[model samples]
Target: MLERLFESTLWNSRFIVILAVVFGLIGAVILFAVASIDIIVTAKYVVATYLSGTHPENFHQDVIGGIIGAVDLYLIGVVMLLFAFGLYELFISEIDVAKESEHDETQLLAIHSLDQLKDKISKVIVMVLVVGFFQKVGYTQYSGALDMLYLALSITAVSVGLYFLGKVGK
Candidate 1:
């Protein structure tokens, strides 16, 4: 009887993972708030620039980079959200609210297994990386054809990698 009881206790300890879900949710909220603030600040900058009627050198590119950075933050927030939801569903239980919703077919937070969760988070992370790369490239000055060629080659490599990732499981 003691052995059975100990085994039961050990098995039930898996609920401790709910702490992970809680922390993940909190982190996601913070990230989303930061991303929102970033976009709002970027918008304010754009409006001020427009009203001032001054096209300083690289102003447009600067604005674009700001927007892309904001997008990267938003994507990271999304990744956190997906991680939280996926962990909760995978380790705890299926989300009943999602199943009951009419939009169940289109739900993004659904995860039936660890692999699905990994796939979802990994894809968003790649997107965030791509956005970050673009933001950095936007500020970089290309001094020669060689620099541009290098940039093109870097983009091609990223594209190929993304293509292969997509082709996985097919």
Candidate 2:
């Protein structure tokens, strides 16, 4: 009887995962909210600058960089959401609302195994990195042919990685 009780308790310990699921969701919500605020601020800045009829140095670059940064945050938030959903489904229970949804897109959050969850999270992370790379590139000044060549090589590498990533989904 003691052995069975211990076994039952050990099995029930999986409920601890609920903490991670809840906190991950909270983190995702915070990230999404911050990203939205960033975009709103960027929009206001652009509108104010145009209305003032004064284009600051690196104005376009700044605008693009801000938007790209927000995209990066949003992608990271997506990763957090996927993590939470996967953990909950794997440990707790299937989300009833998602299962009931007629929209095929809801299946994106359905995770059947650890590998599937990892793949989904990694893909979103790659997107975040790509966005961050572009955000950094936007602010970089190319001073010479060698710099331009390096930039081209880096972009080619990113493109190749994305191509392979896409093939993995197929």
Candidate 3:
């Protein structure tokens, strides 16, 4: 009887993780909303610039940067969603919708293990970082050959990093 009581108590504790996972889902939803807003605002900026009829210096770069920033936000939101769903599926239960879907094997939300979840999130995060770096470099001005060389080196480094990230688990 004592062993039964202990087993029951331990099993019940699994539900505690549900609270954290729900909060994470909510956070991901909020991030997605914010990213949507950001895209809308960027569109407005582009439209206003177009209406002004004056090609300001760096206008193209600014618009590109804004778009990239929005993409970064979206990628971050994706990471959050993957984290939440991964935790839920790992600790709680399989997602019914994913399980019933015809394309269950191809869906991003079909996380079968913690390692898969981590890999998915890491790839998205690396993409976000790469976009962020590009957004910054878009506005950077190089006054000398050395500065241009440094920029080239930075690009090479980022490419190498991405290559290694892709090669993981292989």
On TM-score, the candidate that comes out on top is 2
Clash pairs (backbone) in predicted model 1 = none
Estimate the TM-score of every prediction.
0.92, 0.98, 0.90
Clashing residue pairs in candidate 2 are none
Candidate 1 lDDT at 136 equals 90
lDDT of 3 by residue, 1-170 (tens): 99999999998888888887888888878888887888888888888988998777888897888778878888898888888888888888888878788884647788888789989998999999999999999989889999999999999999999999989999
Worst 10 residues of 1 by lDDT: 101-110
Model 2, residue 5: distance off in Å is 0.7
Model 2 C-alpha lDDT per residue in residues 52-140, reported as the tens digit of each score:
99999989998998899999999999999999999999998999999889999888999999999999999999999999999999999
lDDT of all predictions, in order shown?
0.87, 0.96, 0.87
Q: Model 1 has how many clashing residue pairs?
A: 0
lDDT of 1 by residue, 72-157 (tens): 88899889889889988988888888888888463788898899999989999998998888889888999999999999999998
TM-score of 3: 0.90
